[model samples]
Target: MLAVNYTTLRENMKTYMDKITDDYETVIVTRKDNKNVVMLSEEAYNNIMENIHVLGNKSNYDWLMESKAQLENGMASAHELSEAETDE
Candidate 1:
């Protein structure tokens, strides 16, 4: 994560954008008067949206938590995905 003032960001927009895209770093751009905004790579944004989609649903949240508990309790084991799925 990185924080940069809006002025600095404007002055070095390309550098900041490069860092965000290549390094997958989240940036907080602070404006005057305490206003702020965030910048993230498309991949990061999609991943976050996907997680929100799953965790935002009640049944999905419950199932995920239950599976996590089972794994922690030694009731579940991890397995490799099939080649076809991994190709994605």
Candidate 2:
């Protein structure tokens, strides 16, 4: 995460934006009167939203937890993909 004041961010907008997109970094643009806003790449934002949607569902979350526990307990098996499946 990076933080810069509003005026500073405005002065170097391109550089900051490039850093955010290229490095997948988040920035906080601070303003007067505690009006702060965050900046992030669209890809990052979409990934976050996707995670929220997946984790927010009770059934999905439970299934994920169960899978994790199974893996931790060595109750999972590994299978090799066939040539056709790998091609897909």
Candidate 3:
């Protein structure tokens, strides 16, 4: 992790961002007025958000596959679709 003041960020934004993404796992830019105000590495931030989505899904691929297998075996619950047959 790298800790840089916001002023330093304003002065060399691109170089700092590039260095963090290419070589460091994290970078923080602190503000003088706010002790902890900062900027985080865009790549690492994005990766963290993506994992949240994946982990938050309660019933994912394995559950879907089990449901499919049950349906194929005629063991899943059902309601007659007589309306669709009547429409035909």
Best by TM-score: 2
- State the RMSD for candidate 2: 2.6
Ranking by TM-score: 2, 1, 3
| TM-score of candidate 1 to 2 decimals | 0.83
Per-residue lDDT tens digits of candidate 2, residues 1-88?
A: 9999999999999999999999998999999999999999999999999999999999999999999999999999989987654554
Model 3: CA > 4 A from native: 60-88
lDDT of 3: 0.74
Top candidate (lDDT): 2
* lDDT (Cα, 0-100) at 11 in candidate 1: 96
Q: Which structure is stronger by TM-score: 1 or 2?
A: 2
List the candidate 2 regions with Cα displacement exceeding 4 Å.
85-88
- Per-candidate TM-scores read 0.83, 0.90, 0.50
Candidate 3 per-residue lDDT, tens place, 1-88, comes to: 7887888878998988788777854667776677765455677778888877765676765676788899999897867776554554
lDDT to native, each model: 0.94, 0.97, 0.74
What lDDT tens digits, residue by residue, belong to model 1 across residues 1-88?
9999999999999999999999999999998888899999999999999999999999999999999999899997678887655554
